[model samples]
Target: MALFGKALLIWLMILLLAIANGILRESVLLIVVVKTAAFIVSGLLLCLCIFIMTYLALPWFGRLPASHYWRIGALWLVLTLAFEFVLGAVIQGHSWAQLSEPYTFKDGNLWTLVLCVTFTSPYLAARLRFKQGSKFL
Candidate 1:
């Protein structure tokens, strides 16, 4: 639960940083509202797909306990990452190899780590809190 809270705080911090960056740049930024909306919508769809895929491919992955939520989530992320990369390339008609420029894979990796930490931490905290608390209704 503590980890979850920390994760959420981290996510919020990242968003705050983005907000500050937007202020400095004086341009449009994906603010918290937009980010939240996008996450809710996209996350629902992604979760459904990942849930289905996880159960379906569990046997093939050579594991008996692949039904675990976190494993499915990790796989979902990996799949989505690849899927988006392909979709973007196909739609724009530009392959990574062709439109290559100076890019830092490390930066992307770091941000992805931050996202995972933040999203999961808040979620874990909420889950733990729910387990301990009484009904509000």
Candidate 2:
């Protein structure tokens, strides 16, 4: 597959994983009843998943343009933000204002962190020079 195609596939996989994480996070929270802890744990879990996914998947995308890192990262950021807004407004029935809160960190939402990690993961993976017998971290 081409670079953009590979990147799109990776993004879709991440989206599916994120959806599953949301469901699992909600279920766990219901049982544990600690919002803050649940949020932190789930966020970390998702971030770790993204890290592992990018580590394993980026090389599979094959040769890319010299600017692939920045291009893919920017594209992913735009797509993700749009997906979030559309999903929130259409599926979750959240108002535009309500959905906007997540982007505003002042409201105590850690979603911006999620966005940062997502936006940077591809670029980081593309920039790193993997070596034989090297650890992902």
Candidate 3:
């Protein structure tokens, strides 16, 4: 469907942003902070970026019921999870335990929190946009 196509496009953009965030964390943040702090900061930054991207892209979906936005969020969440596991474990050859380390919440890895934001951002963005009387909506 056109709606899913648009959501997929937006998710690809988010993926690029996520990759950039990881680069920044490794090259810059790690140099400036402890590893735990870097992970937390990077995760927070990614969440913020995801919400901003979702809000900006809201108009691209055209006018839709709130449920559609929720569905978009769900789609994004599923895509993100698939990408992480498939790319990290299958392509990158990481062990399952290694790939899932971030989900354990040890060492200040906020991946679970990031996932929560990714799963909810679309609906939250729609709510904010609607409250702001965005003409695009």
Candidate 4:
């Protein structure tokens, strides 16, 4: 329960960051070489934020059974993806195909990075050693 609460907070933070980035994306797009590059850059930026959050934030949740990390990571991924889809469909008025476009990497979309980060963050956080060479959340 504690693990889920902490992971949910982290996921929410990441989601807010992504939404803020999307809002600013239009201005950033002006200087980008292409749309695909912009997408890639945004995805990378979000991943970096995830890494930082995992390092600094996870500790607050306290220690957990090692196996919980895997469940938390999976939960984060599932919830985040579901949020994205619903936001795209209901709020943004994007069609199913349009929302699905991000996962279509062959078209040069970079959203795959988002998935990779989500899937790995909790487990990575669990494995990371923090101050005093001790394991953290």
- lDDT winner among the candidates? 3
lDDT of each: 0.38, 0.74, 0.93, 0.74
Per-residue lDDT tens digits for candidate 1, residues 33-111, read 4544433433343333323333333333332222333443444345435544675587777778643421233212233
lDDT of 2: 0.74
After aligning candidate 4 to the native by TM-score, how far in Å is the CA of 54 from where it should be? 1.7
Question: Model 1, poorest ten-residue lDDT window?
Answer: 101-110
CA lDDT, candidate 1, residue 77: 47
By the TM-score metric, which is better: model 1 or model 3?
3
Off by over 4 Å in 3: none
Candidate ordering by TM-score (highest first): 3, 4, 2, 1
Clashing residue pairs in candidate 2 are none
Q: In candidate 4, which residue ranges exceed 4 Å CA deviation?
A: 130-132, 135-137
Give the runs in model 2 whose Cα sits over 4 Å from its true position: 63-66, 105-108, 131-137
Model 1: what TM-score?
Answer: 0.32
Candidate 3 pairs with clashing backbones: none
lDDT of model 2 at residue 127? Answer: 55
lDDT of 4 by residue, 1-137 (tens): 56677788877887787787776555775376577777776677778777777667767767767677678778878998889888888899999889887888844556787788878876676676443466553
lDDT of 3 at 134: 88
- Model 4, position 9, has a per-residue lDDT of 85
How far is 38's C-alpha from truth in model 4 (Å)?
1.1
Model 1 spans > 4 angstroms off: 1-27, 30-67, 97-111, 114-137
